[model samples]
Target: MQETPFCLRVGHLLPYSMSDSNTTDFTNPSNFILIGIPGLEIAHVWISIAFCTMYAIAILGNFTILFIVKIEPSLHEPMYYFLCMLAVSDLALSTSTLPKTLSIFWFNSREIDFSACLTQMYFIHCFSAMESGIFVAMALDRYVAICDPLRHSTILTNHVVAKISLAVVLRGCVLVLPTAFLARQWPYCRTNIIPHTYCEHIAVVKLACNDTRVSSYYGLFVVFFVTGLDMLFIAVSYTQILRAIFSLPTKDTRLKTFGTCGSHLCVILAFYIPGLFSFLMQLFGHNVALHFHVLMANIYLLVPPMLNPIIYGVRTRQIRDRLLRLFPHKRI
Candidate 1:
């Protein structure tokens, strides 16, 4: 006998009426059931506790970054401007899904309206793309500051930074807008049960009855074209930065030059490594457990937002000093 489709196996979970013979289709499904993680439902409460903690940290850390950057005159430079953009993007990205995810885990409120799912999908992807673009901008700032110090200020002027910020935001919005439209057009006849915590692009597409090669391929293209291109640019920027740092006359000069890039490199790695791993696993790791895949997806979304401010606070002298000054009496 053929295996039961994943959606039908979880059909009882949906509050919607099912077809009499289990052969009818739910063309649009109107709404979807998001089962937080398959094969680990028993552990969801425990998982929610950890996820809730991370969500709180992400909120507080990113807000603190924004607050400090806004109030501190010393952090008004191009680098910190990019940092502010990063904090904003992180805030939006995490906020896009965490509340709903927590609701599913905490209250068993797993049903999401179709339109709401699409909106969540759009924001999640748009901010993700925006964050990648911001990383590219931050990389360029570091490159100019270290590799071409004299021209850094003139090149990355206030006007230029503003323009770059606008471009990043527009690029993300335009690129991800298409995916949502494409997803909306799909006929989700395969039942409305999404096996993951959130409405990920491929996961939603997988629920469609018709051919979704175009949707899948387009999503992959966006990732490879926009995100891949951004990574390429960041890699080149760091290459030049390293070469410039090594060429400095004194050891102390080299160390100082390299120090400026340390936090950025760490943040980039923290964001991209898990991102790429999850992407590849979704593509090729058919043998991998479904819960593992979903868990990795959640981790990729949560970890960077939680860690970025901490990494910057510990790695940057100015931010660290300012943070200490803010909490002078307490040991933070």
Candidate 2:
């Protein structure tokens, strides 16, 4: 008989494998139970409708941006490239979490395989980190356009954008990989029911009884430190941009400058504020209602993806004009 590979054996043992009769041992919890928003059980039906709508809008909006960018030759610039990157990141982010989220609300299906939860947690953090990186790239694009218009084309060439995209992807994957490894090391010894709709790094880490501070801190680092670095760069870029905008000769020029950044700023704020709130909830939210944690995490994941396309589609003159031309008879 052929021997099972060591990796395969470990894989089988990884879930529901650890149990001590003296202590609460969930060991390898083969699956995790997701109890959707506590106390709102009866309202899940109504909530499903809303979440489904949000998911639909996010898909439609991001795909529309993709379609529009594909057809419009004039939009093949670094800025639009970054915008496309953002759209792709949003799609990944939303797709990672929302389908499972909606399933719990609609199908009454709540059990997620242990490995599946880990995969979900990894992707959720990975794409979210990519979003942060893309924002920084976008900010840099805006900075170059405003602060050094003459070299903007040369500075953010297609090759450069490709490199940036590659870097963003690598960074996200590399930083978030540790989280899953850390989770794998900690033995779970309690009820495997995760008290939320989706599996996040923090959500899963909180379940382990061991000294989980490392996993929690690493999560915080990914959530706060990585994003903070990106946000810091974005802030610096925008500060330079604002100074350049203010130095312009005319009020019209200043408004135009601000107009160029408005959509991106909106996207930034939409992504970060709820993320910060959710991060806080993970820390201090013990005092607050459990539902608030559920709500904030959903907002952090769901709201930005839903809003980014709408924000850009309306605020961007190029997208607006092309949209108008494409559907001249219909009101956008």
Candidate 3:
């Protein structure tokens, strides 16, 4: 006897079911496959724990930096202004996905509402663009300090910083708006289950029922434009900075300048290395190796914020001192 599609009706609820023949049924229980390497169960658990820990550290660390900057009158300079911006961006970056990701892992629920998912995607990209813009601004700040020290203060005045901040937010919004809109236009017919813990744009786009070639192209274009071009600018700025430092006759002045840049360099490497590696691995790695790519993606998202405050505090003595003063008598 042919069963009536195995209907599982409840009181006043007509829950639909799929016949065995129907391969694509919205009514069927979501067949979300958790594909990954066999031994990654332990790895996934550890990663989840690490992610939670990093989320806390990132938030606390950035918040502390923000607080110190806000209260410390002496630290009110273009460099510190950029640092504050970066801290805010990191906070937003971590907050955009960490809570949703932690919730999914903690409760073992993969279901995210469509609206919520798109919102997360938008903010994640928005903050990401803002972070890139902030990096560019930081590089410019350093360039001025190193190459044009005589006019550094004059050039990077309060009004200029305000304008740069405004530009960062506006440009980020403009760049990411299309991607978010395009993502929502697609009808999700394939598995609603996102492979990764979060609703990443690429992962979501791959599940679209409609053709996404244009979206993919545009997404890649935006990623390259924002990340690649920004990186190029940073590289050029650092090159000039290095040239200036090397030309300095006094060793002490060179050392001090390098010390100031050390933290920014560390954070930049930490943020970009894992991210670039993940992008490359995703493009070239085999199906079985995709798990590693996913792991890299998780790390790229999680690690930078965890390290940003530590780098900045240790490198900037004023920040470190202010932090100590804030919690006087408490063992740090």
Candidate 4:
């Protein structure tokens, strides 16, 4: 029998090998192959078109929000300040994965360096946590504006907003730091083929050769502790806001109070509902098709960033007027 070629043996031991338990000892692959959507390879080119459009919209819309807030002296208040933070978070979260995902779809460039994957994973989760915190701050801003109108400015002063922004950044970075560290410590002896477009935490951990219970449980803890706790605060704030609104003597007062939160409420639902669904499906939906889960994961990140600016621009009178003003010749 002819001897096996050296290249074939190395290929079998590393990148091209498909066996899950192929490595007997602790080993780490130099890189991973992201297959994009597992069952949708035939349509990757078409999907890339849609992904490109959404990314373009997200980038343009967020930059516009940041610019408008920066230039408009009247918008230099706590509410718009929190809005700027939210816009920045959305930009960062989407950007963390969009480039690699587009590369996979457009050019079949599926290989991602191990360290790069970890960095992408860290930023994606960190910014997601930060975005949740920003939403809570925005909710509090609305609560004070409606419930304690007298002290709205005094309470959420520029000084206080600065503190809140710092807390949001620190909380996300510190909490998510451990997840990346845990992921890095794992020995990825399984097949290096990740069936998703990006290096999601759960997906990456599931490939490790050793017990991953600690990492998995810690990730769940961070999700609930950060996202769950922030959501609870938002709920309490909104409840107070509603109660304060209804106590107002006139119907017009109630309508006006609720109107102030319409954009914020829309944004909250857009960000949280799909996010929760994707998380739950990953944990419990064992029978759910893999492609469906991956698609939802991608959508959970993509849709919110694209929709947030549109929702705020359409529902917020201030942003709408400023956006309109930017184009004098195309006045409508």
In model 3, which regions exceed 4 Å deviation? 1-45, 329-332
59-137: candidate 2 lDDT, tens digit per residue:
9999999989989999999889989988999999999988998889989899899999999999999999999999999
Residue-level lDDT for 164 in candidate 4: 96
TM-score (all chains, Cα) for each model = 0.93, 0.91, 0.86, 0.92
The per-model lDDT (C-alpha) reads: 0.88, 0.84, 0.76, 0.87
**Poorest stretch of ten by lDDT in candidate 1:** 8-17
**Residues forming the 10-long window of minimal summed lDDT in candidate 2:** 5-14
Candidate 4: where is the Cα deviation over 4 Å?
1-26, 329-332
- Could you tell me which residue pairs clash in candidate 1? none
What is the Cα-based TM-score of model 2?
Answer: 0.91
Q: How many residue pairs of model 3 clash at the backbone? A: 0
Better of 3 and 4 by lDDT: 4
By how many angstroms RMSD does model 2 differ from the true structure? 7.5
lDDT (10s digit) by residue, model 1, range 1-332 = 32344452311222333344333566887788898888788899999999999989989998988998888998999999999999999999999999999999889998999999999999999999999999999999999999888999899999999999999999999999999999999787756778889999888888787788888889999999888999999999999999988888999988987888999999999999999999999878877878898999999999999999989989999998888888769558
Top-scoring candidate (TM-score): 1
List, residue by residue over 192-240, the lDDT tens digit for candidate 4: 6777899999888888877888998999999999999999999999989
Off by over 4 Å in 1: 1-4, 7-23, 330-332
lDDT of 2 at 324: 78
Over 4 Å off, model 2: 1-24, 330-332
Residue 137 local lDDT, model 2: 91
